[model samples]
Target: MSNRKIKTFAPKGTRDFLPVQMFTRNKIINLIKKIFEKYGYEPLETPSIERLDVLTGKYGEEGDQLIFKILKRGTGLDKVGVELKEFTVTDYKDIIDLGLKYDLTVPLCRVIAMHKDKITFPFKRYQIQPVWRADKPQKGRYREFYQCDVDVAGSSSMLADFEIIYMVYEILKTLGFKNFLIRINNRKILNAILEHCKIEQNKSFFVLSAIDKLDKIGKKGVINELKKKNINEKVIDNLLEIILLEGTFEQKLNELGHIFKENKIGNEGIEELKEIFYYLSKTDIDSDFYSLDLSLSRGLEYYTGPIYESVVKEPKIGSLTGGGRYDKLIGMFLGEDVPATGTSLGIERIIDVMTELNMIPETKTITKVLITTFDENLKQESINTTWKIRNSGINAELFFEPLRLNKQLSYANKKGIPFVCIIGPDEKKQNKVKVKNMKTGEEKLIENNKIVEFIKSITD
Candidate 1:
């Protein structure tokens, strides 16, 4: 006999969801999907793997390094088991050709481009699926996680951007999040800040990337990072003075508008923000839930106009959702650009926060009742009763073995089955069944025909 121990672990940063966890996850997903559909966004899905070129150069430099690239198949794969450990990046072009998707936005753009002729104008779609990243796993981060994204393409209106923001508020509020804020900024405003600082064009992304880390590393850390990038000391100081400007949403906008009054792109971004805020003011959305911040520079290179990120103050896990306008991303696939805006709700992080705060309702099992076989003679009766319960739209389980009554009852109790039916010899003769309520220790003699109604009356 062999005694080798087999490896049974899931890869790092992945998870195996048990039934109970799945119940909670499905509850959250269903709620989000309802909201997405309510807002006229149709559901869409994409393949887990995409062409290497399709994913690369879309996310910025750091993001490009985190893609889980797949090695090419064929003769190159012949040495996988023997020499794969020795492979290097220099061999990538000949060997690696595909990678797991880093996020849903790129794939959505690819879809719009490939099917542009067949799709309608101002196309709206929602996608809920897992994306893979080669990131280091941590408390609230994972290599494989689900992103619930909703995007509207072919619409250049700021209303599209506002709708995305409103939906973020709706989903979080519906999920019982009260202490969250939606931070808004515009790439054009950021560009104006860079130009005002006299930062060279080539170093603009580097500066924005550092500013994006302000939330994590704080003001001092961002300054140190810029210094490491050889950004001039004066440039760093000027950049900090602008992004660090703080006040109410309107106050900050007014200040930025004054500073960038002479800048064309900056004023344009300021106007777009004003338009979105105008729409927000007329809605039921509370002013406390959303705000404008000049420092919220989303790291993705694709974000062209307004950018947004939502954060909860309670758990402090970081942003729960984020997205922005990427009018030029679709143009990479199509010959011309298509305006788009969207947000992705980080399901894993949301679930983590909800679970930590004891927000998910306790749901131990889905089965409502268990029918036990009283004896070998009554096995068929138990099966028949279970089928009747199921046909009546109730979830019921039938005991597989004709074991002792105590043992069968223990099984039902352990599984959290609320009700158990015992069709004993006496009850069988009387055309009745002994129904026991597991929680209350109460028993009732239910007629064979009335068992379904009785269970429904109590369970419902």
Candidate 2:
């Protein structure tokens, strides 16, 4: 045999899903889609690959760095034998044109832009699809993963933000997430906080990115990161104090108002937060489930108003979900502003948390019953029995080979198929079939016509 062969290992940060994993993944996705649909969100899909320029400037500086760009075809990539050689290339602009989509929101904007005339205002959409990122993969992080995003466009009211928040609350509750908080903060408020701290604009993005990691790295670690960028130690200390402020959600908002009372942008943000909470208070939402975390500064540049993130209470891996209002994103492509609000369910993180907690539901085989032939001549009987069982709305599998009694029963048990139908000479003589309960190891001889009914009785 030729030694030339492909490598067996998957890429470093990607993984292959086995049968059990796929089942769980599908159930989660379907549940999310149903919730999205219930809220009047239509399904939308965009291509996995988009022009690099469209994704580059949209996700802020740190986010831009994590995009997986695609190189142009025929870029003079050298090759020798079975090994590939490094390209004699210099300019990124010349080599790269497309990139794997990093998130669903941007493409949603692009779609709205291209089809503005065809679509209605206040368009609601949900996209469940895989996105690629070139980040260091760790627990609950993947190079390629699915995001469940539901967004509504063309409405800037605080009501829009409130709806998004309510949707997120319901989603978490439905997903069996109990100890979770829907913490929200406004971009304008973050801007105001920076103004109070006297941090410069050029460094604000870097500052927000560093601060966003506060949950992962403690205050000291965040301070070290800020110091690397030459931010003054005093400024770092004050910034930490401002973002990490504590107390009741309302009381904290009052404190923020006092700090930025003279600052117009800050007061505007304060008023916005106040209005949101005032409206939220009128609803039946659990106060404990949704609240404010001033430190929750989502680092995305596009978020112009209310940034939201959902985090678990203990064993925090990262934000379980995140999104916000971006009033100007669609205008970049359509030349007209369309205000929108959204939330993205980080599916991989949810799965990881569920797996660690053993919350994934035990899923047995889809096939409810197994039909095995007693002998070579009984294959016809097996086929007929399998078809009848399936026709009666039961999942049934047939044994193609003539096997021993123990082997046939073992196959049924191994597959987790609860019922097995065996047709043999003695049963054929009596116009009956032997039904075995795989779970209880009990056998009963039933009339041939009642085989399907007998299985259904046990299953249903």
Candidate 3:
């Protein structure tokens, strides 16, 4: 065999999470699940690969570009070569019919479509899973990441929207995010402004998509992008005026009242939002967390109703979560309408913000003790000890390998295991074990029956 070859690495925009990273990730997932369960949302999961047609056009132009397409299996290579020589693949939509799901929302819409006859109305479900994005990785962005999504479908109730908003606030706050805000907006309100300004419907998506990045790229950048689409300065000024004028939500409603005088659709949207806040006001969760942000447009063609984006108040990261109401999305799939509202919390970003704020608890709670397997002779004793310690409600494990004592101890120390139990021929004969507290660099001999208490004391 050849001497060696350079080892390959994971594709760009993806990463391997070592022990510490996985620890924090699991912690965040658990916390989100707890909050989701507390609000009576059931859990559901779907396949990772979805038909390409089901996902396309739901996210608008830019979003469609980010879907990771999967090619046909087997001798498909022959067809690919022939097709490539003839022309670009853009014209043949059916050739590329499979893709890794870009987001959970689209597949979820498909699920609702197929199972509408079986699923109960007003279904509340939460899904935590990895999604693929064919975008360049940045400081806090990744190609593969987890989105903790909670959604309510089949109900047009504004109360569901309020409940989701409060759920986001409580979940983050409970996880020690003290400085944050849930920004709210309505797409109908945006549509009214565009129509009142005499802007065409086709041009409206381009304008809203540009404004959606205002938080990241600022107003000047948005104006530049809008101008590229041939939008005039007067309309731009009016758009900025509507976005900038801010006060209490009620005050903003009064302001919107003047703009919606001729646009009944806009008035209906404003009234729906008013009822959402009214219902929220009666809840125990603090209302201050939700803010009326006219500029907070979630850039998705599917969102025809209320939208939300959560941002950490202090300077740390970008929006930790964002979602909106997609009223007619199911209609596209089921040939019938279903009102749905959902939010996707960026799991990695939330953990990053928590770490920056020093909110992540460094617990010595993970395996506290490791009982080394000295010999096959004493394996049963070691296993019994591990179970006893575990049965006592302390995290403990038996070393699977029969490596050297020093190597085993080193491995235990590296894993932050504080106590290492040594059971050899001598200790087994004496009915006693040696407990080494790695953190304190101390060791003691304790009776076999008393080992659990000894480990507990060390950990405690």
Q: Which residue pairs collide, candidate 1? A: none
What is each predicted model's overall lDDT from 0 to 1?
A: 0.91, 0.86, 0.85
**Comparing 1 and 2 by TM-score, which wins?**
1
lDDT of 2: 0.86
For residues 1-460, write the lDDT of model 1, one tens digit per residue.
7799897999999999999999899999999999999999999999999999999999988999999999788635756356666645565668789999999999999999999888997999999999999999988999999999999999989999999999999999999987889999999999988888899899888888899888889999999999999988988888898898888767777898888879999988998998898899899998999988787898789999999999988787889999999999999999799999998899999999988888889788989999999778888998899999999999999998998989999998888899999898999999998999999999999998898999899889
- What would the per-residue lDDT of candidate 2 be over residues 229-296, giving only the tens digit for each residue? 99999998888888888887788889998888889988877777887888788887778877887777
- lDDT of model 3, residue 405: 92
lDDT of 3 at 394: 91
Task: List per-candidate RMSD values in Å.
Answer: 2.2, 2.8, 2.8
Please tell me which predicted candidate would have the highest TM-score against the true structure: 1
- 1-460, model 3: which lDDT tens digit per residue? 9989989899988889877777878887888898899999999898888888898888878888998887655425546345434544554454576888888788888999999878897989999989998998987888998888999999998888988888988888888876788898898898887888778888988888788777778999999999999999999998888877778899998898898797888998899899888887787767668888887777667888899989986755778999889899988999889999999999988877788778887754488889999988888989999899999999888899888899999898877887899999989889999998887888898999898887787789
- Which is superior by lDDT, 1 or 2? 1
The list of candidate 2 runs beyond 4 A from truth reads 1-7, 78-91, 220-224, 233-238
TM-score quality measure for candidate 3 = 0.90
- The best candidate by lDDT is 1
TM-score of 1: 0.95
Which 10 successive residues of model 3 have the least lDDT summed? 75-84
